[model samples]
Target: MTGSPEAQTSQTAEKLPLPIRLIDGLSGLSAALAAAGLVLLALNVFLDVLGRTFLHRAIPGTIDMTINWWMPMLALLAFGYTEKMQDHIKVTVLLDSLPIGLRRAIEGVFSLLAAVLLMFLAYYTWVDAARSAKIGETTSSSPPVMIWPFKFVAVAGVIVLSLQLLATAWRNFSGRLPREIDFDVDEAAL
Candidate 1:
């Protein structure tokens, strides 16, 4: 005998194409960027340690370059990628206890809010980046690196995250996405 309607519903999750593929591709790109950023950060750390410990002279602006520039860039570049991979935190206490339909509704609302917030962030970051570029903002330390590039990363990440959120919302509203799409343990475990 077949199980209940809810069981049946669980068995057949409609899969949508195109948007999912696009977001997945973008997420892969974000992961690549994050890997590159980590490599750069590691190299910077290695150089700093080597110079300070053996040579007894730190690289000028190494601290400033990493903290003020590379850190922000890494964070911004990874935002969309992390979101795409569903690595963001959430208050799942309520969501877990709720029925599937109720959970979907709440997810829809949350996705909408995230989309709006990310879009706003993208807009303002772009403005800030433009202003920084125009004013020729640079690190105060020796071997100055322009600050506008980091700002651009902020803008780009937000825009990409916004696009991903929109796609998520659309999939949810259409019932193409499962209530626990973001909570799939296989992907989350990695």
Candidate 2:
């Protein structure tokens, strides 16, 4: 009636409740920004390498930027997108044998548990970010990039990831999200 739990896509996204849609929007936005961060990171690395090879000098704070900024941005920011796409590795061997209703219920319970755990992670991450920001942290590179601002990136990423987990829990609870996740299926089916 609602979702087949067989396929979840943007089309189904449109049918989601407002709160879920809003969360999805935020998740999508964070993911899009993460994508941009990835592009920027690649370009930054490329330029740094080129400068080192041809100009005989590496970019002043390239290492610091990569470690402090780009890597976190790329990794943390896309977490929600990964969850939303259900792209993470999952072991469904045991789940496959259960009845559809039972499977959904089990999945829903696990999603809730995972979401709760992520909430704790987000909280601790926020505390760390706040401490970093309060200290006005900076990398010890020649250019001295500010590390404090980028710390918030971690907070945002964790928050979005937790939210995405909550959304997933809700979907699973509603029994509207999935039939089976067959990793062995043909790629063309996807």
For each candidate, the alpha-carbon lDDT, in order, equals 0.73, 0.82
Clashing pairs in model 2?
Answer: 5-177, 5-178, 5-179
Candidate 2 stretches with Cα past 4 Å from truth are 1-11, 178-190
Report the alpha-carbon TM-score of model 2 versus the true structure.
0.85
Q: Residue 158 in candidate 1 has what lDDT?
A: 78
Tens digits of lDDT, candidate 1, 45-130: 89999999999988787777788667876887777666654667776866766776777777878888989998887898899999
In candidate 1, stretches whose alpha carbon ends up further than 4 angstroms from where it belongs are 1-15, 174-190
Model 2, residue 67: C-alpha shift (Å): 1.4
Q: What is candidate 1's local distance difference test score?
A: 0.73
**lDDT score, candidate 2, position 25:** 86
